[model samples]
Target: MSSSTQPSDIIIGRTFGALFIGVTIAAVLFGLSCVQSFVYFQTHRDPGTTFYKLVVICLWILDALHLAFIVHCVYYYLVSNYANITAPMDVVWSFKLQILFEVLIIQGVHSLYLYRIWIVSQGRSRILPIIVGIVIMSNSGVAIALIWALYQCSMFSELNKIEWATFLTLGTITFADVVIASSLCYLLATSRTEFSSTNSLITRLMVYIINTGCLTSMCSMAAIITCAVMPTNFIFVAIEFLLAKLYVNSYLALLNARYYTEVNTDTNNSDTFHNRHGVYRPELHVRALDDDELQVSRKDLFKHLDDTVHPSRSVKEPALAVTTEMNSFSSV
Candidate 1:
């Protein structure tokens, strides 16, 4: 092979190799998210709202489809079309399907966060939701247009031909993520109760909001920058492949946190129940409540507490259990 052929080979290898690696990593994450979803549904069967459960299921399906589509793209590029007397490959229909699935995954996750914002704000502000909603919808629209334009382009090398649309779509996604993180952190901070346990839960939630939201936005920014700098290269495509997985994994992480917290809380409650009945652990300060308080659902128990109740006694009563339950509930 000539020297010219070597460079061509390297470029082809790099492009398809990066995609293969990205798809593999994304598939692993998707599989993990599926396991997490299963455990999540089993542990927290009642996600309070049917909508929340539906979101989880939808996200899972979208992520799976995204992974499958990418795998097919890889196979077609590397095997089926391998022998074509090719220059750089053109964006095929499989690639378009991948982009569409990505858009769906992103939009679904964004909607989930928007719902969180509404709940965290106690439905008080219509303004934030409307603003964020517009941004999300606009981003999705631009993304679709970009994909359409991508198909119209004669070659993948001409990605820069639709540069404006590309940047707008990515920039909008990053902006939406920033707005979501800031809104969630601010609202959650303001809603904090003076109770120690509640504060602990809120702190964890805030950390989750920041980590997930920031990481996704940063990935988006990276993709946008890469595309701007090297539109003809597959570098941006490699990064873009990771975005959907990151979003899904982040959302799944938030859900899994609830499950672990519930398990811990249940252990504490069982220990308390056992102690109160037979062997009392004085260090825990667990009090023996009447059957009524015990029978009262965790949701109702919180409503039963008055503002003036002592913190120590409240911890020993149903209050602590309710706190754990509510933390899991509200954080979702």
Candidate 2:
């Protein structure tokens, strides 16, 4: 609790300030992209009113909100760290709200992707494939609390003592997210035809998810070891901000790359697919992953995963449906 043990707080005013500014811009760009995408989808609906379509729409909205939240955090991180170092307990409690929202952000990612993989894999896989998302969300909740402690508890020097249990709990949860995500990738990879029906969109997505998870895991490890490593200095906290910026920005890049355009070739079908109202537009199909080599590639990726899935599991008309949809929309 002594001043000597306090972290060597850096002059984060400018650094965090710049980050806040940049992320706020990114948030705006993200919002713009979301609007653009919504307009496009609203112009092209084929399957009519379906629950799955609604789910995808919800994911996009949540993602946009998540970006906005990141912008908010960027501001708070700077403001809280220096401008107002000593917040009243009630204010600190309010700050915890932002930290808790971080969990919701991550949970949004899981909910959006987990079900897709399950459906693509035909709902016939290990139970971990299904419930692992819940575990991920649960642990994220714990991480949020611990994350709050890292800041808010530090507000009260006497209560700054961190719990190892909390560390392990959150760490384990991160590991679980990684493991399940990897499994999802493998399941898709080995599915009878590489992801041919889905094009590289799904594969790109899976790779991006893997990369994000790995980086997040690395950040968590660095954080957990900070106690034994530097033990002092705002260095760890600064690193944390940097990692967070990377996580959010990288995700935005993925959104832009994955959703900003009709990357794949698949948009032929139109079932009132979000086209504002009842409208007719084409769908997009990524590319063909229907060859044996692609299948082999899939097999290789999932070599370590234990799912019994195979390339033959791929649906026969996934590409056709996508291609027809894309062509149909383009013609519109």
**Which candidate's lDDT is highest?**
1
Q: Candidates' TM-scores?
A: 0.78, 0.53
lDDT of each: 0.69, 0.49
lDDT of 2 by residue, 244-286 (tens): 3344444444444334323332242232233535543232212
lDDT for model 1, on a 0 to 1 scale?
0.69
Q: Which stretches of candidate 1 lie above 4 Å from their native place?
A: 1-10, 46-49, 265-332
Q: Which ten-residue region of model 1 has the weakest summed lDDT?
A: 304-313
Query: What local lDDT score does residue 317 receive in model 1, on the 0 to 100 scale?
Result: 48
- The sequence of per-residue lDDT tens digits that candidate 1 reaches over residues 1-332 is 11133324546655777778878877888888888788767765643656556777888889889988988888887788776646335556778789889988888888877766555444366787778778878877888888788777755556556878778888988998988888867765765554564556557767887998889999999988887776555777878889999999888887665445445545644344544447545533333243224423332212211112121122244555644544453333
Model 2: residues with Cα > 4 Å off, grouped in runs: 1-94, 130-134, 137-141, 144-159, 163-166, 194-206, 218-332
